[model samples]
Target: MAENQGFIGSIVETVKTVFWALVIAGIFRTLFFQPFWIPSGSMKDTLLIGDFLFVNKMAYGYSYASCPAIRIERIGIDLGPDDFCGWFEDRDGRLFGSEPERGDIVVFRHPVTGRDFIKRLIGLPGDRIQMKDGLLHINDTPVEIEDAGIFAEVMAPQGPLGLRPQCANGAVGEGATCEKEKAIETLPNGVSHSILNIGRRSADNTGVFTVPADQFFFVGDNRDNSTDSRFPQAAGGVGFVDRKDLVGRADRVMFSSAGRSMLAFWTWRSDRYFKALE
Candidate 1:
């Protein structure tokens, strides 16, 4: 009987320990940081499809409750930007936090779809933004762009020929094609980073967009492939992201793998492990 009692006690203790550990972990995630997986090639070489990174919540102070979900029970008077569905008028406000600087990569809740999105901040509130012939223009001054040579891989080709991934060594690989234009773009604030241009697309040339107060303009480094503030929400773009929608800033890549499944250890990209995000 004593032995059985000891075994039961051990099980209970293990359960209690796990429960408390999870609780502590959840608290830490909610307040300090959160892990995010890169599932798309939108960020491209800057951030790969399998990269896992942590967003610093303390960077912009903590939101009321981390903007838990898309739908929130309206607890107070409705705020403006009425087009956003399931938006929290009261709980949407951010707590103590600094404003996002230009060239910083930000993660936020998409106003129209309520889905989370990560993109680079290009235009701040009241900044004029436009794209002309595949180049970024801010406040009517053109940003500098320097060609960085070719990056040999075109992912998710629009045509039906499937993939034709190119390697730097003139070798062809399956499920990949290397035929992209890479360039280094310098923001007005002197923050320089790499951008990929996969030929001119519809968003390459757009009219002037004057960002409104308490809002921001964001674009992806993958200029032609991204659907960002360059397009309006009505047209399946993010439109102007509200300040209240800001989540946190991504700082670094904790780990990365090449394939869809992390369990595929052979596909692990050791070089990308603990890689710092520029």
Candidate 2:
């Protein structure tokens, strides 16, 4: 009887340990940092398609309680089944957290779909943004950009979703190749990054966009391919994202793997491990 009781005690201790471990981990992820995987190449060359990174929640400052709620919903928990828990809760402007810089790579909840999105902050509150002949203009002044050269990618016939439009122009008799013009762009704040231009794409030209107070304007490094602040929410693009929708800033690439499964260790891109984002 004593032996059986000892075995039961061991099981209970193990369960308790695991329960506490999960609780601590959940708290850390919710209040401190969160891991995210790159599933697309929208920010390519800066953040690759398979790069995994941690977003520093403390970068801007502490967000409201809705931040935790958003994390919970991501794990399939239906907290409220109402507007309050749908990642659309209104957070006061006076709430904790500092404003994001003009060129920081930010992850936020999309205002329309409540989905998480990561992009480079182009315009801060009250900044005038525009695009002309594939160039970005801020406050009626053109952002500096220099010709970097060509960026090429291997594509299947079907091709990657957003990359197709650019690839279509660079297809060499068809079989599976794509290319785009690359440029080194400098934001007003002196943050320089790489941008992919797809010749004369539709988003390459647009009217001026005046960022509102308590909101931000963002865009992808892959200029022609990203559906960002340039498009409306109803058009499947993230419109002006509110300050409360901001999540955190991506700090570094922890590891990367091009394989579909984690077991495919051979596909790991070891060179990209621990790469810091600019």
Number of the top TM-score candidate: 2
Q: Highest lDDT among the candidates is held by which one?
A: 2
RMSD of 2: 3.6
What local lDDT score does residue 249 receive in model 1, on the 0 to 100 scale?
Answer: 92
Q: How many clashes in candidate 2? A: 0
10 residues in a row with least lDDT, candidate 1: 157-166
lDDT of 2 at 105: 94
Cα lDDT, model 2, residue 25 = 86
State the lDDT at 193 in candidate 2.
93
Poorly placed runs, candidate 1 (over 4 Å): 1-11, 64-93, 154-176
- Encode model 1's per-residue lDDT on 1-278: one tens digit a residue: 99999999999999999999988986777677877877666777798777888888777775543533323446754332223323444565577777788988888878877667899999998999999998999999999999999766544432122223323344445446666788999998899989888765789899999999989999998786677999999989999988877778998898887665788788687998888777
Residue-pair clashes per prediction, in order, are 9, 0
